[model samples]
Target chain A: MTSSVTASLPRPSPFHLLLAFGSGGLLTLMVDFNGLVGLYATPFYSSWVAHGTGIVAALAFLALLRLRPEAGAGGAKPAAPLWAYLGGVSGALTVILTSTAVNSPLALSGTLALGLAGQVVFSLAADRWGLLGMPVRIPLLRDFAALALIAAGSVIIIFGRGA
Target chain B: MIEAILIATLAGVLVSLSRQINGRLAVSTTPLVASFWNHVVGFAVLTAIGLVIGALWPAGAFSAPWYAYLGGTIGVIFVASGSWLIARIGAINTAMLVIGGQMVFGVALDLVRGAEGHVLASALGVALIIAGAALTQRRR
Candidate 1:
C-alpha cells in the first residue's frame, strides 16, 4: 500500500515549467474566447462554451491521471481546511449564476479579481501549512507579484474593448 | 479590445500563480483542483464586488446570462488540466502547442461568426501572446 501510494505520487520532471507555460497560454485563450462569445451572444452562450470546453478538458485530465498515477501524486496535499473548499464552491456558483444578472464586462472583471484573490489566499494558506506536495514549488515573492500584474493587465484589456 | 487585453493579462497572472501554488501543493492535487479552487474563490470575490457595485453604481452593473456563469465551471477544469500538462511539458513547448491550437480554434470560431479585424492583426496578436508566454516561462 505504501509503495502504491508512493508510486501514485508525482515525480519531479525537467518538463514542469514547459507544461506550466503551455497550459497557462491555453487557459488564457480559453478565457478570452469565452469573453468574446459572451459579448456577441447571450451570456448563456458564453457559459455553454466555457462549460462545454471544461467538461471535455476535465475528462481528459481524469484520463491522464488514471494513466499516470505517479504524476498525479507529485504535489503536496492541500492544507486548506474543509471550509476553504466550501467557500470556493460557493463563490464559483455565485459568480456563474449571477453572470447573466450582471453586466458582462463588469461581471468578467469581478470574476477575474475574485479568482485571483482566492488563489492568493489559498496559496498563502498552503505555504503557511507546508501542505504543498514534494515536486511542486511556489514562486518567489517577486514572481508572484509579477503574476499579479499580468492578471491586472488581462482585466484591463477585457474592459478596454468597451464590451 | 480592452476586454481582451484585460482577460489576457488576468489569465496570465492567474496561470502563473496557479502554477506556483500547484508546485508547492502535492502533485497529486492536479491542475483541475487548483483551477477549481481559484474559480471558486474568484466567483466569491467577484460576486461580492458585483453586489457592492450594483448598490453604488447601478448603471455599471447589468444582468448576465445564465449560460455565461456555467462557463466558469468549464474554465476551472480547463485550467486544471492545462496546468497539469504544463508540469509534464516545458512551458515553451506547452505554450507553443496551446497557442497553435488556440489560433486554429479561435480563427475557426471567428470565421463562422464573421468577426471583425484583419487576419494580419489577429496573427500579430497571437505572436505577441506567444512571445509573452515565452518571456514568462522558467528556464531550466
Candidate 2:
C-alpha cells in the first residue's frame, strides 16, 4: 500500500490504471454481493464476522508486505487528521446495511442499483467540496447531466417491472 | 421494503465517503496502511455494535464456508484500490468507473443466480448510466 508513495513516483500506464480500477470495482462487487449471500447462509446472523475475516486476511497481507525491504522505505508521511480514520466506520455501516438490504424484499440487484445511485450523488458532492481532504474538482453542467442520467437509469432499474 | 432500500442507498453514500477518506489517507501513506486503519476501526465498530446487540459472534458462524469468511480480504482489495484510484482520478470519475464495473459484473451474477430483474428496464438503466459516466469522464 505504501509502495506508491515515493519521491520518484513513476506514472502508471493507462492500461495498468484501468486494470487496477477495474479490479477494485470487481472486488467491491464480490465483497458486497457474495459477502451478503455467504453470511446469511451461516447459522450466526452476525455480519461482523465477514468484516473480521477480511481484517485477518488484510493484516496477513500487510505483515507479509512489510517483510519486503522497500515496503516503508519511501518514508512517506504519517496519517492525516483523526477524522480520516473514520472511513472504516462508514464502511462497517455499509456492510451492515447491505446485509439487511440484501435480505429484504428489495432484492440484490435493486439494492445494488440504489446504492450506485447514492454513490453517484455522494461522489458529486465530495468532489465538488473536496470533502475528506480530497482534491477539489467541481462538476460542470455536462457532469450534472450525466449524473442525472445515471440516476434516472438506476431508478428505472430498481422500479421498472419485468419487461 | 422501502426502508431497506433507503438504508442501502445511504450505505452507498457511506461507502463513497469511506473510499474518499481512505484514498486521501493513502496519498500520504501506503494503500495498505490506509486500508489497515480502516479495517481496524471498522472491526472495532462492528464489535461494539455486536456487543450492544448482545451477540458479537453469531451462533454457528463457524459453520460458514471458508470462502464466506474471505469477505474482509476482498474488502481490503476494494478499499486499497479505491484509495489508490481516487487520488489519480477525480472522485466522480472513480465512482463512475467503479459503479460501471459493478453494474457489469453484478448483472452477470444476477443472471447466473436466476434472480428476477427488470430486464429491459435494467438494460436501459445500464445504458443511461454508462452514457452518463462517459459524459462525466470528459470533465476530468
Candidate 3:
C-alpha cells in the first residue's frame, strides 16, 4: 500500500516567538561586545571592516540561499513592490547614520529607541504599500504590550549597569 | 538611564515595523535584499554625515588596527545570517537562538578579557531578556 503525504499550513507558535526574542537579545549583546572590541582596538578599522564584511557575508548568504532553497521554508512571498526594498535599505542606513551623528553608542538606550521608530515607520509603509513580505494583521493591543516588554528589557541591559 | 530608554524605544519601533513589513513581504527576499541594502545605504549615509561633520576622515580613520576591521566583517556576517534565520524560523525563534549563542560567546570572551563584572551582568541580563521574550511568544 502507498502512503499519502499532506503539507499542513504553517501556524504561529508561541515557542517560536519566545525563541525569536531570546535570540534577538543574545544577538544584540553579541553585537555590543563586538562594538566594544572595536572601540578599544581602532574605531575606523571597525567601520571599514564591518562594511567589507557585510558585502562578503551578504554574497555568501545569497549563495547559500541559492544552494539551499529549503532555508526559506516558512517565509511568505513578497506582497509589496520592489520599492519597499529600497525603503528598508534607506531606513537601515538612516538608523546607522543617526546613531553615529549623535555620538551615541550603539548600545545606548536612546539609539535603540530611534532605531525602533525607524523600523516602525518602514513597516507601516510596507504594510500600506504591500511592500516586503510583511503579513497583514490587525495589530491588536497585545502586540504593543509585547513590544513594550521587549523595549524595556533592551533598555535595561544597554543603559543599566548590566552592559 | 535616559540613553537606555531611547535605545529601547527605538528598538521597539523597529521590531513593530519589522512585523508590519514582514506581513507585507512574508517572503524571504525582502529581508535578504534589505540586509544587503542596509550596508550600502549605511555606508553612504555615514560617509555623508562624516563629511558634513568634518569627522569623515578622522585621524584614526585609516590608522585603526587591522583587527578592528576584521571584527566588523564578522558582525556583518552575523547580521545577515541572523536575518535569514529570522525569515526561516520566525523572528522570535531566530532572535532567541542568536541571543543565546551570543551570550555564550560574549561571556566567554569577556571573561578572557578580565571583565568579570560585565560578564556577570551580561549573564543576568540575558536571562531576563529571554524570559521577557518568552512571555511574548504566540500561544498555540
Interface RMSD, one decimal, each candidate: 9.3, 4.2, 6.1
lDDT of 3 by residue, B40-85 (tens): 5555555665567654444445454455445445544444454544
Residue-level lDDT of model 1, residues A91-136, one tens digit each, is: 2343244453244454554554444444445444343344323233
- C-alpha DockQ of every model: 0.14, 0.51, 0.29
Question: Clashes in model 2: which pairs?
Answer: A1-B30, A1-B31, A1-B32, A2-B30, A54-B72, A54-B73
Residues A26-124, candidate 3: write the lDDT tens digits.
454535644654465434334534654666666677676673322433545524455433434433443444445346444444564455454545443
Task: After superposing candidate 3 on the true structure, give the runs of residues whose Cα lies further than 4 Å from its correct spot.
Answer: A1-26, A29-49, A64-80, A87-133, A139-149, B1-33, B47-57, B62-67, B75-127, B138-140
**Candidate topping DockQ:** 2
**Residues B1-140 of candidate 2: C-alpha lDDT, one tens digit per residue:** 76987998998898898999888778877777778778889878978877787666555556655665666677777788888878876677677666655555555566677788677777887788667656644222
Candidate 3 displacement at residue A70 in angstroms: 19
Worst 10 residues of 3 chain B by lDDT: B17-26
Give candidate 2 regions above 4 Å deviation: A1-46, A67-79, A99-114, A159-163, B1-8, B136-140
Q: Using TM-score, give the best candidate's number.
A: 2
Off by over 4 Å in 1: A1-163, B1-11, B23-28, B51-67, B91-96, B120-140
CAPRI class of candidate 1: incorrect
Q: Rank the candidates by lDDT, best first.
A: 2, 3, 1
Native contacts recovered by model 2 = 0.63
| Candidate 2 structure quality by residue, lDDT tens digits, A1-163 | 3433321122234543465547645664656545554555531233466567667777788888763212532565654777877888898788678867878886766777778878888998887788878877766556567657766765675565333
